[model samples]
Target: MSTPTSDVHATSPAAEYLAFTLGQEEYGIDIQKVSEIRSYETPTRIANAPEFVKGVVNLRGIIVPIVDMRIKFKLGTPSYDQFTVVIILNIGHRVVGMVVDRVSDVTTLLPEQIKPAPEIGSAMNTDHIVGLGTLDERMLILVDIDKLMSSAEMGLIDAVAA
Candidate 1:
């Protein structure tokens, strides 16, 4: 299990997120869904896979697919650095990797700190977002990894980029 750092802040039920950054924004997913976080390492290419799919990496004994969340989210490519990380997440019994800029903390938030994704005129797609959590000085984008890892969408991304 990953240890929580002193900068981590938790409030209540929603406070169970593992927060990370991609570019300038901060995002979070439920900690229960995460298996591990490792340094951003190059993965072996899988033929016929999507461009956004960074191919596969061996985790323990299992081969897992890795996704560059920057490309998936329409953000430009992120430069790999010492701080870059591949966060392993288990969604619907399948393990996958998400490349992020850097991990920040394990944070907690109260129910009131979270709000439903706005439906109208939003610049970003809200489909994968469960809600937005607010801290006194910052906010975290709460993601529904299952939705983000939807097989149909994965197939589409793969088919198009292959």
Candidate 2:
């Protein structure tokens, strides 16, 4: 005699995500957009650039623009420490970088695990929020880095010429 099986596999397709944190919230992005992860480095400051645009870093021979997600999201004050990391992403023909508090890990989440973000009246923008992902007891705010980084508000359209 065998006990009834409760273990069942999710029917939804699985995709890997790069999980990161900003303040008290956790976020995830499609791993395919990520090219590399580098330690924090003070980039060359660009004059007249927005606050969220930290500056630009010469990655190899390529000049990459770095954006601070915390500042972009208006998440109060942002502090950079040893744990800070920069995720290099390749969107279309443009390569950009984003600064986050710290990267947790690469997680594989099934489609069923992701839920559409609820619309709520808040000062924070949710346009870039892909959805909310539920994994065990943790919830991740999945971000559409492509859309967010390439948006006109980011002023990356001009920078893409680089």
**Highest TM-score model number:** 2
lDDT (tens digit, per residue) of candidate 2 on 70-115 = 9989998889999999999998887889999999999999877888
Candidate 1 global Cα RMSD: 7.9
Per-model lDDT? 0.82, 0.86
TM-score of 1: 0.83
Candidate 1 Cα misplacement greater than 4 A, ranges: 1-14, 120-124, 156-162
Alpha-carbon shift of residue 151 in model 2 (angstroms): 1.9
Candidate 2, lDDT over the whole model: 0.86
TM-score of each: 0.83, 0.88
